[model samples]
Target: MSDSSTDNEASLHQYQDIQYSLKQSNRKTTSLFIERDGSVTVRAPLPYDMAKIESIIEQKRSWIYRNLAEWEDLNRVQVHREFVNGEGFLYLGRNYRLQLVDEQDEALVLKNGRFLLRRDHVDSGMEIFKNFYRTKGLDRINQRLTHFAPKMGVTFGSVRVMELQHRWASCTSKGDLNFHWRCLMAPLAVLDYIIIHELAHRLYRNHDAKFWDAVDKVLPDYQRHVSWLRHNGAGMGL
Candidate 1:
């Protein structure tokens, strides 16, 4: 496979103390992002020049630095796990030890406060665990959505739990919601926050004041969960 982009040309550009990749497209507004790996990218309208893009970057300098610092802190506690007995895995913010069983009809099951895995599936344990999360996540997320949708005054389409990479959850233009399977590893409250965050997107596409206000109406103390995910996200992995 090869990489191709018709919307924008990517090149490394620097302004003062900031170095970033500028992506200009037909977008109506310029948006900045700190990628999952901590690289800076700015997407601006096609008509904007380098000077204008740099100015936008300068305006958001403090925000960029703050999020980059948090990204650094997140990576510091990155977790490494092995598919052996007594190794702990996270489920709803709780740690459950792993136990390999010689015989089981299913590849994995949570029983007696521990995760029981079939011994033969050790090599493909990651996918098995992801399947477990995705399966369980769909039921839980849909249930929560049902409870919260009316409160938020929105009707959603289908809900799915899959690999969303760096994002916790996303809402489509058609009102469908997709969540990362890793979300099932967080606390129930945090998971609700994730759901509400996406549901709010059903009303507003951007993270503006109105979008946040919609979230505040449902969960008053949502910032703590945001901070929790930022601080603890690294450990929520295989």
Candidate 2:
């Protein structure tokens, strides 16, 4: 770990086997989370007490363990990408391999059971792929949200597709929707889940019981999609 991460990591108890990352900010509440990579994090108000934090961790031990187990299971499925010939790419729930060709008007396109790309643009293939998704995601996500928003009782004023570092999608307080272009690679059902998730946030603004209930009303099998994202998210990008 770097010095900054060392600053972030701490122990619940000095003699215990478990370690957690600590982040102190001017937040309203203290929360513990397990990241996709299976690392534990504790976010708290500034100037927190060691004993109080330990007590909270002790109380939520069961929830933490269960979530950690799920994380391990999801992470156990290896998902990675390689920039080479015949490399597989995911688009709308289907896998397509790369087929480099010398003649292509566009930078990239999906055709005949493969992603056709210009041989000269192989060095920039990842960007071309991202642009392909970004271009398609704009229309696809917008259409889906337009179809579902009225039924869900949420209206988004605008939608944008771009690169997101930490989240699949987000809804702004001003009623704008932003989705990561990578989301276009997931199954349509999973994409719906992501859309519903952001839409639900427009109403609740937090992931509480009410938010999940809203999601459940929209997609009853939302957990399956959530699990799919957790397990396969590692491979969604180049």
Candidate 3:
């Protein structure tokens, strides 16, 4: 609960329950958030006083370096995908490179390590790309859902995709499945796990052992996919 400000310095504010550290992230950010569930985070350059930051946390009678060390460990498990040339894009477990090409098609093309799309289709170019991926990705997921849902002893009324800021997927009590379009960036196994997880809710609707057992009945290696999402799913905009 410490706050410090200076006209010639960056503004610094500390919270009592923050579980994060100062970091030099490659992404553009100014505030960090650590979830109450033990996720450490960082906010990039804004305004701050280093001495005040130390003092504020110290007044809590907590170990200064211990918090820093915890942040280091948490950072090791964070995954941030850089929107840069030659960086790999994951779609259904396949890797593709982002390539800007001149074409009237205005769609995504997967060919030979490239995800080619129209270079100047809209004002917000990234939004166009995201939509392209979302459409195609939903098609794939729906196709798989149609194939697997029946086999897994579940039935869903519908499957839809939307732009969600926080969650990857959710299920309605009425048996509809809603998934985040960003899931297009995760591996195929991870995508399946999410779909199955939500579909399982059509029967159980809660995270009890029986629900997990239902999931395991379909995806025996569900734990691996869960860990994969925990470690790498954030890069997919989670």
Residue by residue across 157-197, what tens digits does model 1's lDDT show? 99899987457777899999998888899999999998998
Q: How accurate locally is residue 140 in candidate 3, as Cα lDDT from 0 to 100? A: 83
Candidate 1 residue pairs that clash: none
Candidate 2 global lDDT: 0.76
lDDT of 1 at 59: 90
Better of 2 and 3 by TM-score: 2
TM-score of 1: 0.73
Clashes found in each candidate (C-alpha, N, C closer than 3 A): 0, 0, 6
Please give the distance, in angstroms, between residue 135's alpha carbon in candidate 2 and its true position after superposition: 0.6
**What lDDT does each candidate get?**
0.83, 0.76, 0.62
Ranking by lDDT: 1, 2, 3
Q: Candidate 1: lDDT of 211?
A: 82
TM-score for each candidate, following the candidate numbering: 0.73, 0.73, 0.63
lDDT of 3 by residue, 120-181 (tens): 64345467657766788779889878877897778888778886535677778888777887
Q: Tell me, what's the RMSD of every candidate?
A: 6.7, 6.5, 11.3
lDDT of 2 at 208: 56
* Model 2 lDDT tens row, 1-238: 2223334445342315346777764576888777665567787765666677677788877555434432333223355666577989999889999888989899788999999888999888778888999999999998899899998998887889998756677678998988888789999998988888888888897555787789899899887887787667766776
lDDT of 1 at 38: 66
